[model samples]
Target: MKSLPPLGDDAVVRLSRQGGVAAIHTLTRPREIAFAQCNIDQRTRICSVLEGCLAIEDPASGRGDQRFYEIEVCYRIGEQDDRMVMKVPEDRAPGELVHLWDKGEVL
Candidate 1:
């Protein structure tokens, strides 16, 4: 499992108050990525693991006034033909890297 480059310096991973809606954003691009509601925990975990590579901001650290619980960035990995693929927006193309979310369980 090779890790891909960080999304960007302005990238933000938001945890919403309404139904725990999680989304990814950037200074130039808002809502650049969205994940399934159930995968929020998994996504957060991934961000924590890749914190060194991401531009994570903790709301508790007296950051911006965003109501979102915590802010983070997303990382990707290499694509494997055997894994299930998630559809990414055309504009937010993964190019040569595959998002960790794109790969479903190996089963």
Candidate 2:
């Protein structure tokens, strides 16, 4: 496993690279991104597709004291990341899941 650089999400809603390595991204804002990874050789690295992202002040996932929304997401593994991104929809608010659906990643 080659040590990959720290990938970051720009103002855009998507972050895309080439590799299947494991990486951690800071979701401080809302955005649209497709996570993927491709190995040039036997090595792998964390890959991502950052685009159409809109960082919301409110945390979508459970993180703050007042829980506004809580979602469960499951991703399907593909060549790089998962072929499909899946998640259990929660009726916590209006147009919640719809928002996710609006993005490329459906829940």
Candidate 3:
């Protein structure tokens, strides 16, 4: 699998909602990448991912307890299920951030 480009300090993370769905996108100088899309039921996970990315972009703007890192975002392709999953190991996750395999379905 090809790795995604690292998110720079200037990366812009935005979250928008339409009805019961929420979408997260990251915009850099060259391109805008769709990070994740989830239903209202999965709001927590999507919110956490957005918070993490924003924290990484500007640490001082984030909560002091949150620790952001470069996480591997993956999609389950060609499968019956389609979802975007952010892989953050349990040990590395802070108390507020979701762990990699905790919910299984990110989107």
Candidate 4:
């Protein structure tokens, strides 16, 4: 199971290549989105938000191996899916970086 460190509540995730809207087997973890309140359905395959904004970016725009993709989620209250193909980065993801934020402390 390949997993990148958990991202903070305000941190931004950039993608390396364009992703397939087909949806990954497992979507981004809702727990990773918010600090400690109102998480989304894990099986929803949707992006949720407790604070900040969400965006799917292409980190590999100027990098190499433009095939990798990232969820690159921000934050939202309503239901929103990236009908537009998402983009993740290529470079090796960080190690055990989960829990990026200190929960509640604005990243």
By TM-score, the best candidate is: 3
Considering lDDT, which of the candidate structures 2 and 4 is the better prediction for this target? 4
1-107: candidate 4 lDDT, tens digit per residue: 22233433333332222334443434332223332342334212123321111232343442442334344544333443222223333243222112222121222
Q: lDDT of candidate 3 vs native?
A: 0.34
Q: lDDT (0-100) at residue 14 of candidate 2?
A: 30
**Candidate 1 residue lDDT tens string, 1-107:** 33334443333343212111333343213222344433556555544434422233222431232222222334333442121112222233222112332342111
Q: In candidate 1, residue 91 scores what lDDT?
A: 30
User: Against the unseen true structure, what C-alpha lDDT does each candidate score?
Assistant: 0.31, 0.27, 0.34, 0.31
Let me know the TM-score candidate 1 reaches against the reference structure.
Answer: 0.20
What does the lDDT come to for candidate 1? 0.31
Say what the RMSD of model 3 is.
Answer: 15.9
Provide the lDDT at 46 for model 3: 47
| Model 3 Cα shift for residue 76 (angstroms) | 17
Residue 75's lDDT in candidate 2: 38
Candidate 4 off by > 4 Å: 1-32, 37-69, 75-88, 97-107
For candidate 1, list the clashing residue pairs, or say none.
none
